[model samples]
Target: MTKTVEFYFDLGSPTTYLAHTQLAKICADTQSELIYIPMLLGGVFKATGNASPAVIPAKGRYMFQDLDRFAKRYGVQLRFNPHFPINTLILMRAATGIQLHQPQRFAEFVDCLFRALWVEGRNLNDPQTIAAVLTENGFDPEEVLALSNDESVKAKLKENTEAAIKRGVFGAPSMFIGDQLFFGQDRLDFVEEALRQD
Candidate 1:
């Protein structure tokens, strides 16, 4: 059977964006399948009582520096979003909805959002900016927003978040190969190692 890596992510996370950049290549190198799971980081934090490193003054400062190092090492563009702590409820819902309804465009949605917020450092917290970004990327912003309010889509996102919390997830960029959970974009080496194992 082909190995599958379940990536639990929220677009608000720079680390998740960094991880997203590398996961495809890792999966390809290992002949593994990459599954994107859109879960709300806020919900995970509330449930697990875990918070972002940005909440700490010192950690937040050093975290970005470290993330920059990783981005450089990965040869990917990663700019810190000035609009830190973007509420990703609507965005993750759009991701879940796209994964459920327009499966083909799911990756496209993920890519645009990640690049908009992380690579280009757009302020996605604003509705107008979000619409403009979506439009620029050829996505109908109103349509995508409508999908966010879909009952089924909302329920699926909640379910994914609940399932992640139950599996000991406390933050974004959490990856699971079989039952082994690897948290943090920094842990991709372990994830890759797991993929190569039984």
Candidate 2:
């Protein structure tokens, strides 16, 4: 049986976006299943008493530069958003909705929003901006917004965050090969190695 790689991520995290670009191919090559788990980064931080590396000025600058280097190494486009800290509650809720409802289109929605928030540097904080992005991508903006507000979707997202904290997750781009938890996009090599093991 193929091993499963559970990817716990939040859209507000650029590293999570970077990991997403590579994990699919990694799973394909390794005969593993990639499962996407959506959670709120802020909630995780609050639950674990962990803060973003970006909270420090020098570290934040260097982190972005490192992210760009990784993007180059991965041969993927990644432009840093000027709007640094985007509140992704609605976006994440929408992701949970897609995962629960339109499973077929989950990947597409993730790619679109990742590009919009990171590559294209769109201001997704604005509802109108989100609507435009959704409309431009041929998705019904109103429908998606409504779905994002669903009670079940909200609770699922909450559960994801709580479960991640319980699993010792303090940041985005966390991947699990069985119960081995790897944090950060840079740790993907170790994750691959874990998958190769019996």
Candidate 3:
């Protein structure tokens, strides 16, 4: 039987960026179907009473160091965004809109936004900056913005967030192989193993 991995993610997460780098290769290796579910990290936190590790000083310090090691190991660029904690509400809404309407461009959207925030450390919080990034990537900023603002798109994002929370997701990069939940980019090895077992 073919296996599947339901990847619930929020683009705001640096760890989710790391997971983005590896999950594709793992899925290809295992021949598993990868489904991307864009969710709101802030919403997840609010619903589950969980907070980012960055809320803690020492843990945040150690988290970055650990992330750097993983990035090197994975050979992916993961620079610290000066604009850490990007309000991903709109970004994720845009992503979800793209995923829903322009499925072909979904991967491009993910790559562009993830690279902007995580690799190039671009500040996505600014509207002009986001527009510029979209233009540079051959995306129509006005169209994307309009799509994001659609009531259905907004409601879909909310629904996705709620569904993720209901599925025991409290953070970004939560992967589910069937009923098993594997949270965090660090748990990807287990994800691969799970796929193999299936």
* Residue-wise C-alpha lDDT for candidate 1, range 1-198, written one tens digit per residue: 999999999999999999999999999999999999999999999998889999999999999999999999999999999999899999999899989999999998899999999989899999999999999999999899999999999999999999999999999899999898999999999999989887
Off by over 4 Å in 3: none
Candidate 1 lDDT score at position 124? 90
lDDT values, one for every candidate = 0.95, 0.94, 0.95
**Model 3 pairs whose backbones collide:** none
Candidate 2 residue-wise lDDT, 1-198, digit = tens: 789999999999999999999999889888999999999999999888888889999999999999999999999999988987999999999999989999999999999999999899999999999999999988899999988999999999999999999999999989998888999999989988888888
Q: Which stretches of candidate 2 lie over 4 Å from their true place?
A: none
TM-score against truth, every candidate: 0.99, 0.98, 0.99
Better model by lDDT: candidate 1 vs candidate 2: 1
For every model shown, the clashing-pair count is: 0, 0, 0
Error of 1 at 158 (Å): 0.3
Q: Residue 3 CA error for candidate 3 (Å)?
A: 0.8
* Candidate numbers, best lDDT first, in rank order: 1, 3, 2
